[model samples]
Target chain A: MARAKKPKLAVWKFASCDGCQLSLLDCEDELLAVAANVDIAHFPEATRAVIAGPYDLSLVEGSITTPDDAERIHKIRRRSKRLITIGACATAGGIQALRNFARIDDYINYVYARPEYIDTLAKSTPIHDHVWVDFELRGCPIDRFQLVEVINAFLNERRPNIPRYSQCVECKRSGAVCVMVSRGTLCLGPVTQAGCGNLCPPLGRGCYGCFGPMEAPNTMSLAGWFREKDTSADAVRDLFRTFNAGAAPFRKESEAHEQR
Target chain B: MKPAGSTDPLPAIIDKGGLQVLIDALIGGGFTVIAPRLTDGVIALDTITSVDHLPAGATDEQEAGYYRVHDGGGGRLFDYATTPQGWKRYLYPPEERLWQAKREGAGFAIVEERAPVPRYAFLGVRACDLRAIGILDAVFDHGRSAEPRYVARRDQALIIGVNCTRAGSTCFCTSMGTGPAVGTGADLVLTEFGDDAAPALLVEARSPAGRKVFARLGGRQAAAEDIEAADAAVAKAATMVTRHMATDAAAILKRNLEHREWAKVAQRCLGCANCTLVCPTCFCGSVEDTTDLTGATAARWRRWDSCFTSDFSYIHGGSIRRSGASRYRQWMTHKLSHWWQQFGSSGCVGCGRCITWCPVGIDITEQVRRIKDSEGGPH
Candidate 1:
């Protein structure tokens, strides 16, 4: 008999809209190619088929927003050989981290009919906050191509080719008219990470930081440009506090905006 | 051989009706030809046949928060300014099917469909619109890893860019260093000098693919005077544009995130998401699944979504931007300030679609001017 395959892939979710995991399914043509290489032991969103682990790779999505989820992730971490967090929710606490700045109880009361029935944590936190993440794929929904690239890298034992630079690199390469300079339009391409491929700029719009902050982002200087363009500090603060609001640099910048 | 920027004129002139024959030739060669047609009170990219279908003698008056039609003196057919829709509908698409899945006996089987090939000829494309397409190509086609879907369409399509003889009030491509004149990235570029001057087209072949399309046209090479006329036409259009935004806006916006004036702009913003929907490059989307009655089969779809939506930023139990002010701030700053950090340039192309399509008519340029004029933040 042929020897059983060793590598097992597991997908887990927490508090999210499921957009990130959908990105895995969005791989469409790439899905079968990926599954052929590895044993998809667990992916509840894609299939009901479950294979028990210790799995070789685990792709985690969403954020830790409930007490139960917080405890459950630990067991997953122990069972997984390599754990990677995917999307804004899992890596940056998601847009739900907005609760960190405001009153969580007010949200509970406003959204839910019976606040008592809903068991939740005070603030949404990233998987990295709880356990070590081998890698973190940024974006509200990680770009499907990048998702494939990450999976391929891990399978081949190599580093992923994800860029750490800002959207500016993409914009210049595409020869886009500088929205801010030419049109005096407000945009976030200068400080946000390059992944969404400068989607907003050519549409005559700005970047919304869906992919989160880049490595050592010069957000302060970019914020200065926003001001010079007549963007208010509060407006700039709000920009930082979006999508990947809980990310460290964005969080710090947003907090500073709130202080003013 | 003419240099890339030589002011040489062309000898041959096609009759106004000859354009139909040209389009027919393209279609005959198995190309899906798309051009601007008057639709629902706006010029949009739609399928067209003869020159009559074109928005002949139509012009547009575009300003911050305003766009209206103007009569184009009954001579030029492709005289209208750009509409709310950009070429993204063809390149990026509003929604796409990433894959399809079906339940197997024990698990699930999935089939990924081949990306659609866009073997179409885009006619009457404006200089600004061409610039916008170039920007998208950078993001979608020429990247270290091109989006397979975008690449398929981009590789197969042909572009026929038109020089703008009229400028809208919101037009600022001249300031942004993009164009009022046609630039590279086009297969064939036409500059209309009206009937008497034999409407000349200064064709530049950027790629072999472009050369093939131009070679098929059978038009003679341009002369010095024809080249000069095209140049004069572009310069005239550039002068007619009324709007102007600061050049150093990125640096200024980057520093003023905490300024209070955002609150003022927020007051006028309705959060209806008109600006984002009409934007050519706003590619943010959401995913959905529709299942049959048995629930065994489902089709997952990617739909256009906006950050302005309340649920867009929702994580577990709540949303990040709870107020109209925060959402507006998020949209504007991302477009102007943070886009540079992410893509290496500002995201906006100065087409003014957002300004015109916005129901509330919130002028982004005006908002920036207000923020810059205020003294609360560090300049």
Candidate 2:
């Protein structure tokens, strides 16, 4: 469907690092072109200038951590024609979702002086868990190039060219030597979705799975290999329990090792 | 040194020092000299201007899902087996812009990409890689619709093939009928001996361009003993490769379409597309057309793609190969069975790159053998 003459684009935040929103501002040159095509109606990160809703497109960042965020997402979803979630926070509940596995009351008492004053949910959840999300752009602080592509795709009414395969494809394409194979480093590249331009492998380190689990990830198979390499069950559990811990595949995999 | 005009006949012997002379002449001839260099803990093909740039005395031990570089290899430059990357990176790049368009008054003006192609002199190309290049040649340079970008680069490229003295654990070139020795398509071929021997190279000029570069070296004619040593070194490499691919792989794979082994292998396959990306002959690419935010300018780009992805088989309804089992079957079947029908040759060059680079070490050779053994045939 053709959008308005100049679609009103809104950027919304919940509970996040704000790095994913900064990625849009980090678009540097492309941001200017994006502004010319769409009305930046509400982007608190870039500007305080607010244009009232019924926004054509809304770029949502962060997870639903508080009671207010859980209720606020429903109202935002109703006002926007299309909504896309950006980064690990909005897509997989971010690193904060580690609390989902444990008692939040203990954490509140441990950190905050008065536990009675704290107002939060038991579990941090992705935007899709609260409201319908059109698309989810993955990454810890979503890839800026992909952010531009997602916006461009929405503007042109086309599917965004984001790959659902593992990061190994990008690693091999960039001619980066397989760090796991060469150095025996425990890598999440085989199960992590392709994007982030293969940031870690070439630098002699393993992928922390910032982009989250790839489509139909065989996490048990990879964790089995990790165990074969003498990686402790606890270490294997901690590996999957990272930035994309709340992602289903990673969450299920991490929970499997918890009993051990 | 002899003058550049002097004609040196085929089959000459040159010490290790003469290699530097060859590299110098190729660079002076205005060609980007690419050779095997140690980079990122693996032997990679990159631009080198001198002999010292080669991964001398360094050899890598390779197996399924393993690779490690070790020092103290008798100081032989071409001692290493296959490099992590092939010459396809230079000939058919991973990504290239096809064309661009700009918004005009009422219509858009299409602009053709006119980037200059560089003439390359590829040093230390292995037999498997040379065959891989030939396979790519059929796919891109001499196919129904020849790719202009590949043609422009391949036509002007210089190939310097090197005979392997030692094969890696993953190597199966002999079974594929591709190598261990330089066979065809190279302008110049060199067979190197270890330090215990003369520590020299038996060089042969296979083409006129090879002779032109050979003449500049002014090397002595190779003696009969030197040729014998070179032949012995190549023969030893053939013996080094313990792994073998069944010669009738195409027939075996075509017959076992519904083999149970596919599902078993898919469990470990990861469907990561690493095997396809690391493969030299696995030439599949996808085109993406993108526009600036303002929609004022648009460009088309072709980048490497693999069959292992769900998107690769996505049609109007949905992806054809949805399961990992189906995708794995498609990749193997296409590589062995379909490739023979489409191109007159087998797609795999027995380079073992797919096996070596796979994260899970899902061996293609072992997988083929399992399928072959299931029929209870004496393969």
Candidate 3:
């Protein structure tokens, strides 16, 4: 098999805190190894020297909030052979998608003094909601280890070894006694996917669903459990409306409780 | 415990001073003594250097979904039953690199890597966990897929069980028929007796290794009353286990396969796998293999997996257990029914870790009771 000179990797950003991009940088030990084997094509966060791509692998971060971003992602989708969306922003609609619950005009008028100047879409949407994605990495700030795994999988033409189970798996492996049980704290590790290793549970706080819902999550059952913990209907609704609330599973669970 | 036909070693009285002598002797003999200690807000099994480091007067209050460690205001070692983590974590790690590969000429060369075994002396190991360690030994060491790492750890480690005087709110060890007393797994059994203000321990050797260690400690010979107090302590603990689940789970669940109550229980299930993860006997794991960016280096990793996930039962077409109801049924059925058929014993040791650690407070005992009350239940 004839291989093209080292695979060209491009990183793109849209509407996000750049926390996901920072995770790629945070891979200090593996960065030198990656730099020698792969070409850093079009990463604004890492370099201003942009090597225009017909890239082999592209990592897209952040949600599509603005109309310009919505159009720009389609172009990126066309340029890259395999595009993987990283973090909650690029996979789900992200925390900013809280605006999806209300009218965009109402949000702009309330937050910005000059509402007329704001140019944005009605809903903060994910890349898959617009264009096709080869893979999606789910996390508020994607796990660095998973980022490495995704890159490795792309190079080898294989599926990324990512877990579709809940955060409880990692918590248990770490020998973390359940905070919900040991401290009476409400945690979302039960329904949330396993990606973020340093979740709030082991740190004396409950999981706030930082990672999106696990594959085929049973939100209804989890909600019932929450209700049994004496959590108010309003509180449960508010929780589901937080990060990744625009995702269908979480959205449905939140909307079901809106009646109360 | 001592083998059959072996002479029973004389029981001895280990006062507060004698207990310290035992700890020092174990450490001096190149063994790390792990005991229950208060750290942060939880009582975890931690390596202890001194008797003061132990959770002497500290005991935890356990409920369906709540646990809180509180100080008992006096030094009374072995007064508390702590940690459901068991001895599994040290032996069977949560995540471990199984093998590493590097490019050699054209083909990759893989080399297996095993962690060096650490000799440990487990202190204050309750009877329930002693039973759990035995169950794990049967699963990993004697199974078709033998794990040498787990067996190595088991062989190197020393068990010192403490008899339980009281049971946790979630405990049902009596129903599981594995607790209230340490029988055959421990090397040495320690029973803290006498008044709380002035406490003493009765130390009995169950193995030759324990007898040698006990000979070093300056404990006096135990009297007949000392033995009676120890037996009475175990009896009281058996009575304290109010939560009951019929052990005939295989019989009850097999008849109730089509029951509607499964859906009712599923309504409160999260499919989080928290129950399985925290369970002492739930051993299901998946292996992962990947190469680095250069394709020159590769590593194989093993991580603990849970059956609650959709991917756990995946086949060529799709996941067999798609709905939450199906996943919950499969897990409960496997633990209670299939395990007995396969291992000649129930998977559950009834330590109550699964119930207490579950995020939503779903009680296993309650589910078992509901099934037994159904039409399919045995009369």
TM-score of chain A of each: 0.95, 0.97, 0.95
Once model 1 is optimally superposed onto the true structure by TM-score, how far is the C-alpha of residue A222 displaced, in angstroms?
32
Model 2, position A12, has a per-residue lDDT of: 96
What's the residue-level lDDT of B225 in candidate 2? 78
lDDT of each: 0.74, 0.89, 0.83
Candidate 1 ranges with C-alpha deviation above 4 Å = A1-260, B1-12, B142-145, B195-202, B375-379
Chain B structural similarity as TM-score, candidate 1: 0.90
Worst 10 residues of 3 chain B by lDDT: B1-10
Of the candidates shown, which would achieve the greatest DockQ relative to the real structure?
3
The worst-scoring run of ten residues by lDDT in candidate 3 chain A lies at A1-10
DockQ for candidate 3, C-alpha atoms: 0.63
Best by lDDT: 2
TM-score ranking from best candidate downward: 2, 3, 1
lDDT by residue for model 2 over A1-260, one digit each (tens)? Answer: 12358999999999998999999999999788787778999999899899999999999999999999899999999999999999999999999999999999989999998889999999999999988899999999899999999999888777788988899888988988888888889999999998897899989899899999998687888888889889999999999999999999999999999963
Task: List the candidate 3 regions with Cα displacement exceeding 4 Å.
Answer: A1-4, B1-6, B376-379
Q: List the RMSD of every prediction in angstroms.
A: 13.0, 3.1, 2.3
Query: For residues B1-379, could you state the per-residue lDDT of candidate 2 as single tens digits?
Result: 1225535464888876798889989999999999999998888999998788888888899988889999855668887788887888899899999999998978999999999999999999899999999999999976579999999999999999999999999999999999998878888898888464337888888778998898888679888777878889999999999899987889999988998899898788788888898899988999988887666788999999989988889889999999999999999988978899999989999999999988778888899988888899465
Higher-scoring candidate on TM-score, 1 or 3: 3
lDDT of 3 by residue, A98-191 (tens): 9888898999999999998999999999999999998999888888989988887877777788888888777888877777777767677788
